[model samples]
Target: MPSVEAGTAGPLTALSPIRLEFAQKAFIVSGGRLLLVRKSASDPFHPGRWEVPGGRLEVEDDLDLDDHIRREVWEEVGLKIDPGPPFHLWQWFMPDRADLAGRGQVRVVATARRCRPVTVDATLENQESDDHLDGCAWVPLDEAGTYDLIPSLRPVMRAFLLAAG
Candidate 1:
């Protein structure tokens, strides 16, 4: 949530060749299973893949990282989540999406629990225009591992499963 200092005129730009934008992911678990959504085949990146429910953080959101995750989850699946500590952080270049091309997306992934029992809504896809989430499921970690997932998420999912047991 911290911003570049006031006095440093060019430090932000000079520090990195590519601009790093902030994004977040929520690890929502309920009834010993994780909630996963399938991206529509029409998606530009990682189409037809399963992933945790979350999305990019926008400056207009006016939230810290944790709040952003909570908002994104609510917007996506209509579920309220209690966010916990960040479990992982990683950066990647999303060249497939024209708007995101040439920019480094820094994602902070956090674990969270549903505030209450709720149905996963496949109809409420979030702000990312290109990502069409068409299916939803509550699957055990082992079962989830068998499906094709967002490539960067596999390791984190495995680690969460192992720690959970």
Candidate 2:
């Protein structure tokens, strides 16, 4: 009989798997302005705060990462975007909620892709009534600091501004 070590690759499974949720964000920039969406007041996370347009990946969707981002942008802000390669990456653990039932906080890993509007005159609109977004704006990149943005995204915004300058 062979003894399996707990830390070895042999059949000793004692550790729980770490699950991370994947999400994508678009830094949609047009004419020196960045597109932002305001989360609804009742939103679970970052209520009434502004953030770039994007969302988590859906397992049911057959689209690739770029197309998923495009769909999210369209559904959230009614804009067609040409997504570029990811420019920034960030992750955050979800705050504890009653609904989680002691399952531990969910960790979300997100990528921020630089994107451009497909049309010069494309108008921004919140397409879904039940979507968490309540408002949209094309704020000048230099002036974005004045807005109430999501706290976790402050560093990313700062880096973007610094890089733009």
Candidate 3:
């Protein structure tokens, strides 16, 4: 990731006025299978849907994006990854309840990175009491599309499969 120094003139400077949230998702692969986690039934956004491990970047996190992703992966699924460069990028706008009094929706920009697990052991430990993730599996890459994934992730899965082939 590149940063713009304060007062520097560039095309990205125009984005200063907009509030964008950054998030990272990992496609952790091992033994021709991809990891997926099921969102809890009570999750407001996409309950019961399957998604890759990762989450939004918090302001308090380390400046390094890779480190931030590593932390999120560990926290979400109890696994370590060697994150590769982002293979896909996507964004969506949703109502921002925190800023409902002012702006109605906030744009969430996210990157889906290709990753490899540090070890062949793909056993997942999802702490149900701590987060919305309730279950996990290492699905074969060719059979991934049959699972009910979040809407935004469908194309990502297709692209990944094609690329992996």
Candidate 4:
């Protein structure tokens, strides 16, 4: 569980010497609350679990890391946010029998604040992917643990709450 603090200018040099691929996620916070999404049970990867909004890098569409975060947050939750500097970085490794085994990933976790009033619409629940997201909500930071969040997110959430406080 290697976690990088906010505002890192370069990769996690201390954890690993090997070059690794990168991904990004946003712990979107608003008014002392955090946004979390529920994965569809029909999906394979941690289905029915809670997670922050994010996705793998789209080299073809996203021009850079910040662009990817902006696009993914909107596409996943229909919220406009001003993503702050990355708050944490997780070195991800799937089990040998896992679908994404052998390959590793570095998740650049950033904090963001809502820029506009969230517009509730049908599109928010209707995810475009087959098994990506099913539902989402803004939970109070203190109460976020009641939901079954993704395992890696628990520590990140704790660190974030402490830092924000």
TM-score of predicted model 2? 0.80
Shift of residue 39 alpha carbon in model 4, Å: 0.9
Q: Which candidate tops TM-score?
A: 3
**Which residue pairs clash in candidate 2?**
none
- Model 4 spans > 4 angstroms off: 1-20, 95-126
TM-score of candidate 3 against the unseen true structure:
0.81
Stretches of candidate 2 off by over 4 Å are 1-18, 95-100, 120-130
TM-score for each predicted model, relative to the true structure:
0.71, 0.80, 0.81, 0.69
Alpha-carbon shift of residue 13 in model 2 (angstroms): 9.2
Q: What is candidate 2's lDDT per residue for 1-165, written digit by digit as tens? A: 578876676543433333577889888889889888898987877899998888878868937898889988888888888988887788987743543445445678988888889954434464665557878888998898778889878877877777778
Per-residue CA lDDT of model 4 for 73-141, tens digit only, reads: 778887666667776666554333223444433434334322322443314643467437888888898
Native-vs-model 2 lDDT? Answer: 0.78
Lowest lDDT 10-residue stretch of candidate 3: 121-130
Tens-digit lDDT track of model 1 for 76-117: 777766777765666555443334444544334334332333
Query: Which whole-number lDDT from 0 to 100 does residue 14 have in model 1?
Result: 49
User: What's the lDDT for candidate 4?
Assistant: 0.66
lDDT of each: 0.66, 0.78, 0.82, 0.66
Better of 3 and 4 by lDDT: 3
Which whole-number lDDT from 0 to 100 does residue 53 have in model 1? 81
